[model samples]
Target: MTDPVLPDLWLDWCAVTGTPVDRRDEATLGRFVLQAAPSRKLLNTLRLAPLATAPAWPPALRGDATALSQLVHGGTSRINDPDVHWITRLRLRRLVFAAVLLAPANQGGLGLSRIQARGLTPGRLQSLRPVIGRTADEASCPACAVWSWLDVIGTNNDWSQDALRALGHHRDPAGGEVHRHERDDPSHGWLDWPDHPNLLPAIDQWGYLDRYGSLHPSSLSSLVHAIETLADARIAPARPASVEPVSAPPRITAEEEAAILARADELNARVARILKEYS
Candidate 1:
């Protein structure tokens, strides 16, 4: 059955349906997340001063297809298609990143190398993944883990991989986070970050924003369609060609072959005779 409105958190929706959050489209959560989104008000209310300058949700987010379409030319396309998914993924990613950038120094950015955002193995990533109430706190240090947004959405494909990895993060084999200069950073070296320093509180602000974006109907539906597309392509990229069996020619005996060769010789001789006679 189709769901009318998406739950406040992706995990909440997953829990109700008993489906993995990564495979959200399989849950049948229904049409679009037409309800509450850009849960920015929750983050905005943070009394911190550094976040006072971060950009707020874009106005285009609230309107209907027509208004949203104007934000990016393809925003009005069918929800199941890649265009609309792109619209949801990109706009939402930007929205959250902008908010993080504006967050109070303690809550958001840390001198920790932004490079920690890259090369996260899916296993380690899952360990860091956040649920509704616990999203921001999944990582021990919110500042060090500020780049979680990249891992949440980036690992799937080339475009997303590049966009998120561009903001790179790295860790030592001991799970210690490392910060390297922009010019020297390499994609190869990193390890699972340890849970130590557990000093920072949960990044509730980011958690709220992530759930808003991922649980939205647009994001979930696009994921389902994308999975189906891949499956369809694998099953049959095009119609399969039909095969027909052929009967073996009657076996020819040695005598029959000799007779055929004799016949051919006879015809050739006759033709040659005729040619000579004509000449």
Candidate 2:
């Protein structure tokens, strides 16, 4: 059965906010925004009312309903993307390395201090692709997606562009080339910079690498946004190019060719006359 309380609460929210009731379903309402701050606004409004608690939703809808409640009533957590153009390869590598270390143990992330002791080595990240992609898909969290992205593209411009295109995210045409140091080697891993600075800790419990740790907020926001966009993306296969047929045209009699040309000329003349009249 459809949960009546959610719709009623949504209606009440709409009435108070004067937002047009576009959708009454639970899922749409979960992501619904009104003037950009409806999540906070609706929650505050509901808090003032005498409602003892949030409505009890079914198993199918409970997840969405709970998420909506957390977003509006509890709080909304915003994770930004990392800026690639301005970011130095060293910092980018550090961020990705830290992410790998900070990934949950359940996801096969190396949360060990001994692994951290070995330092940010390219070898450490070589076998972590499975965990990264797995966590990203199953966690239903933006942080996981960020981890997956860091694993997939890291500091490689080609992979970055390809991944962005796959996710339907736009890369700036005039963003200019990314910084490349002479000794930088991406094949080793995102953390392979030997001479680069070590700014990140071996392990971050607060999920800094996923967020704005040493990186700029806008950059992190951009990376997260791109990964989130990747969720609904459907990459279609490239269409094959059309090839011209090699078969020769059918031979025609001289008289028939002449008649065809005459007919074409007559049609052209008729079109010209019509155009002249219209003009």
Candidate 3:
């Protein structure tokens, strides 16, 4: 099914007011905007011409009410996207490695004592450069370079289909390019890059980070925003009084409880020894 056209009223509200409409106002405003001339003009600009072409609402759509409510209220989490999780994991790994390298030899030795005492071996250090997507040879644009690193860390060592769709592309049935004025000259409009036919899926992957890196405040926030947008657009309209739900607690089975209890006992024993001197 074709994606739902982003409502012009919503877009205008976001642009002019710099805030999402409160739930109380959204439905009423949405209906009114559907019939307004300005809204029609905005829809035309977005090329959503045949308003009647929207797909019949899917039966499974109602099953996603919980997700839609989360999006409208802005209270979802990010672990849902594997790509974002992978990016965060890699970043954490890098941070851990840096910390180990900086730690003093007497404290929790990281096997880096020899390296700290006598400097890093050229070959060993060289191996790390490629892992971080850096070269000793040249300078690159910082933004592009970071995205290149993300490409290596993200899905299948390539771009993700979801990321591509977020940037306005379809896989099976193709879609048109969005063109915009590059300069104010009335004749100098530029189409978005990574054009189709020659488009590489890896290049398409960069679009996700580009569009969402800022929007995703934390990994959890990214998940929440993604779920909300998808749920709202693809599922049902949110209710006027619905507020975003709080995060549900993690589920723990009996075996997990035993593990926690064992860990607590071990910590208690250590604390008891430390407190004996005071007694």
Candidate 4:
């Protein structure tokens, strides 16, 4: 799914506020200011002038007294309506904070950190799927969590280990195969990665079970297709050997490997930048 319209909304706000743009440090803060600008009067009263000027705001905004104070005193302003200022400031602060937390980070420049990355792994991914059955509203609930996990994988660029671990597998002590059978009932079912072709169907199934008490037929079909595709890709044999047999396997040039790594690194960096901005 594409990101929510909040970033565009925030951009509109920035245009109205005449806020300065800093490409380097203030990218996130610029977004916050634009997003929060609709409530400019309240923001002014709260003295959240710094938010208007901050290069990057925290991904989550807390509503404690300290936050309140920072919002009100951060910027300079001539408005002095104390009574109205305090009430509007408090109300606007809560509203803005809630929007920030609930909004999808990828769509904007918001993202989870390394610590947050740990919670968004595959094991946790399934737990969120059950919520989809509750209602169409439930789809987004699981999606948000799943997207967070994807973001972690995409940003880290460590598909072999981190990605596998996020998918609920760990190396066994005796051998290097993925560990299984250690978990309880529902989680135990997810041990075989190849069994399920893609993660989307499982996500849909989770939603259906959580919301409707049964899986939809179409959803099941989708899951089957995904699994078939995965299996086919995995078991497919490599291309046939050349007509003439060679003494040894062809060696990859250092330049070629370096180019591939560079490309991968660039892609990861781009993803990371987007995540940071939206976060």
Winning candidate number (TM-score): 2
Using all chains and alpha carbons, the TM-scores for the candidates as numbered come to: 0.18, 0.23, 0.20, 0.19
Q: Candidate 2, residues 71-164: lDDT per residue as tens digits?
A: 1111001112223222222232333333334333332233222223123333333333333322122223323433333432342323244443
True-structure lDDT of candidate 2: 0.31
TM-score of 3: 0.20
Q: Pick the lDDT winner.
A: 2
After aligning candidate 1 to the native by TM-score, how far in Å is the CA of 103 from where it should be? 35
lDDT per residue for candidate 4 within 1-279, as digits (tens), equals: 211122333433333444322221355554665566546554333343323221122323322312322222211010122222322222222222222222222222122221222122334323323321111221112232233223222322332334433332211121223212122222123233222222221122111102112223343333223222222222222223347366676556667656655654454344223222222
Task: Provide the clashing-pair count of each candidate structure.
Answer: 11, 11, 5, 23
Cα displacement (angstroms), candidate 2, residue 74, comes to 15
Instruction: Give the CA lDDT, 0 to 100, for residue 98 in model 4.
Output: 22
For lDDT, candidate 2 versus 3, the one ahead is 2
Give me candidate 4's TM-score against the actual structure: 0.19
Q: What is candidate 1's lDDT per residue for 104-205, written digit by digit as tens?
A: 222322111112211223343333233211112222223222343343333322224444334322221112334211122122223221321211112222
